[model samples]
Target: MYYFFLDDKMLPVPPPKMEVKVNNKNKTVNLINEGEINIIKSPGLTEVSFEVMMPNEFYPFALYDNGVSNFITRLSGQQPTITYAKNYIDGFEKLKTGNNPFRLIIARFNQKFEYLSDTNMLVTLEEYNVGESSEYGFDWQVPMRFKQYRPYATKELEITTNENGEQVARVKQTRPTTKEVPKAYKVAANMTLWEACRRASGGSLDWKAVAELNGIRDNNVLKGTVLNLK
Candidate 1:
């Protein structure tokens, strides 16, 4: 069994008695002989679709009333309503202001009707359809589609000063630190000091530093000459 809770008040409606489908959109890449690789992309939104039955008691007059009053009231006012249709319509309108998305709680049950996993989803309504009456009552099937709304997580960095008055990077989280190691490179024909330093230092060290360290007064050096890079 699954349950969906709309806005803050938990609304008085019971959980839908239908299957809820969840879809996750992800990016994938295919490499020959390597199968498909899932790329680390942004926290993509999710799409959910389900059917809901709204009883007559829970239905608001605004949904069935045929007039421009409902539209004007919902569009130019902040008043709250108990009607499910008005709540959803108002909630969607509020999404344009960049406010917090609506909350959807999904509760699952096992064969014994025991509690299973309870997942909380923050989403915005994307689409909805009102089905035709198949039974003889006010109850109607409302198909709803929602999209997940979540911002991407970003890495935070901390900058601090060391005892020697030198600035150092102090990460708040555990991360891999890259250490530059000294290397040796042989000068090749038609290669300048800048080019040699760039190749030996991985394009990080300056050419002046390399020339000074090697005691090379002339920028031009003979081929086959080896220089120490630190």
Candidate 2:
């Protein structure tokens, strides 16, 4: 048999290669389609993510040609990069103040819905009646663009140095005094325990707790007993 120059079968086969061209001006990534669409939307998902580029190790032909020919370069790293600038969001600075309001805008095609809340947390619920065709579905998978007022919670605080000369941080929890109590010595005459408790503690101190604390029973007040106001 004629001898071959070298065992060609012993040589390693070349692997496929790919190149990427990123357009920073448009914030778009272009890559060869391997049956994977870059755009994704899911109703059952809470978070969304996608790979803009693969690692150099995963590239089979990356080492070929001494790792220089047909090499991939990140667009951001390229000189004279093409980058686009977008306007800052409106009311972002104003939202930092407590006066800013919350807005929830949802759009499905042309349909739109918006909700406003003064608080940071929001609760939404939907229900379907058992007899009404039993059709109910929820999709929390969509990405939400939230514009929050800066400083969700704030209070005017006064701080003083401790004995060790260390600064101390204090938080105050204050809500509107919704309920009013009877002023000192304003306990209604011939009132029941419930009535007295209602008046004495601004209707805030639990009636049961008040009764237990002051030895009152039910709605009945002790007759002819002087109330000791502390």
Best by lDDT: 1
User: What Cα-based lDDT does every candidate model obtain?
Assistant: 0.55, 0.29
Give the RMSD in angstroms, all C-alphas superposed, for model 2: 33.2
Q: Write the per-residue lDDT of candidate 2 for residues 1-230, one digit (tens) a residue.
A: 01000000100112122122222222334568755335533322122111111121224322121111122223223222111111111122333233434322111111121112111111111111111111212101111122222234567676878999998877776775454544333443343343354345533444456556666554344334444333
lDDT of 1 by residue, 1-230 (tens): 44345533232344345444545356799999999999765454567767765544423323221111233335544232334445544544565344566666564556654447655677877766665575826554667777777754567789899999999886577555433746777866323455455445544576667788999875445457798876
Model 2 regions lying over 4 Å from their true place: 1-186, 222-230
Off by over 4 Å in 1: 11-45, 58-98, 108-114, 130-140, 153-157, 171-230
Residue 139 CA error for candidate 2 (Å)?
60
RMSD of each: 29.1, 33.2
Q: What is the number of residue pairs that collide in model 1?
A: 0
Residue pairs whose backbone atoms clash in candidate 1: none
Candidate 2 overall lDDT versus native = 0.29
